[model samples]
Target: MPNKKNFFLTCAVLAVTLTAGCSSGADAETSEAGVDSVAESVGDAKGGSSKSPADSDTGRPRIRLDTTQFEEIRMYQGYLRCLKDHGVPISVKGNKMPEADPGTLWFPNIDVAEERPEVEKACLGKKPLHPPELDPQKNPDYMDDYSKWIACDNRRGLKVDPLPDGGGWNYKPGVTQPRNADQIDKECMIEAFGGE
Candidate 1:
């Protein structure tokens, strides 16, 4: 039979050995995991051209993922304006640049707008949301022919619709006729010119 001191000493040594082994194993695993994650992060950081650090003089890769949604600036401004006109508070929708489609622009997770019936009405016949003047597909004030439309803008032809079918007839601040395209009492502008 072992003495009491010897037995206690053996137990202590065993415990220390087990703990040291487990910690060393854990540290090795952690180091391997960290290296793997760093490599993955650098790989994902590659930009459109997929250049490496040594490939260019920059010694760093730029990442610009084209994965973003769409946003209609004019329509959102109108929405906010309409809310202010009606004495209601307005909030921002998505902060990211919305993705582009054939016609629709998607902005997900708009806050404080869920309870607004006016905003809901504003978004009718379209996804996400947009003010009326912006939706050429639905605005009664603007006729549709895809031709007679003129994009009057202080910021170039960023917007397009029939010229005389102009509902937002008067814009404030910086404003002027379109430098890109012009139109008159034409197809969609029929109603805009007092219905043909």
Candidate 2:
């Protein structure tokens, strides 16, 4: 079986890659809930290190947290550090990374918010990382069901885009919908599709 952290890192990397250069309006509350859940699952209650390094761009030290279980985050952090070293503007969600833990981390698309052509060019030179295989089959019935699910969300006052023509599902793109679209209660989907 795949390591669970690797699995999530793969999924998150894929999501981030697909949505690269797109501005994010992530739902702060929803994201906090996820972090809290992860913290609980990992038995960690401590917040990340306090006091960003004095040289940090915001004149505030960068937050650091231990992410021992998710090793891939270290590389992402290295990437961010590289960008910062090269004068690229970046921001981490909630301004934190797990203390001492490295291997995976999350950040908004700096490319979308910053205009550092040199830094962007440098980032492009690095090899791109791909997520593990997660192909979801898209048969007609699934598409039809997804359509209904989207409709249900719309009816419930959740803003969701229509699934593309083939109507396949992937991590959603763009910030036009709710920040928590990925975690919208599946009970609504169940109510809409009802086992199809």
Q: Which candidate number would show the highest TM-score if scored against the true structure?
A: 2
Q: Highest lDDT: give the candidate number.
A: 2
Model 2 per-residue lDDT tens digits across residues 25-75:
222222211110011122336854443222122211111111111233333
Cα error, candidate 2, residue 107 (Å)? 2.5
Give residue 74's lDDT in candidate 1 (0 to 100): 25
Q: After superposition, how far is residue 12 of candidate 2 from its true place, in Å?
A: 4.5
RMSD of each: 31.3, 16.3
For model 1, the superposed segments whose C-alpha errors exceed 4 Å read 1-71, 91-113, 122-196
| lDDT tens digits by residue: candidate 1, 81-173 | 444444555444333223322222222223324566665443321211222233455555544422332331223432432224333222232
- Least accurate 10 contiguous residues by lDDT in model 1: 20-29
Candidate 2, residue 156: the lDDT equals 56
Cα RMSD for candidate 1?
A: 31.3
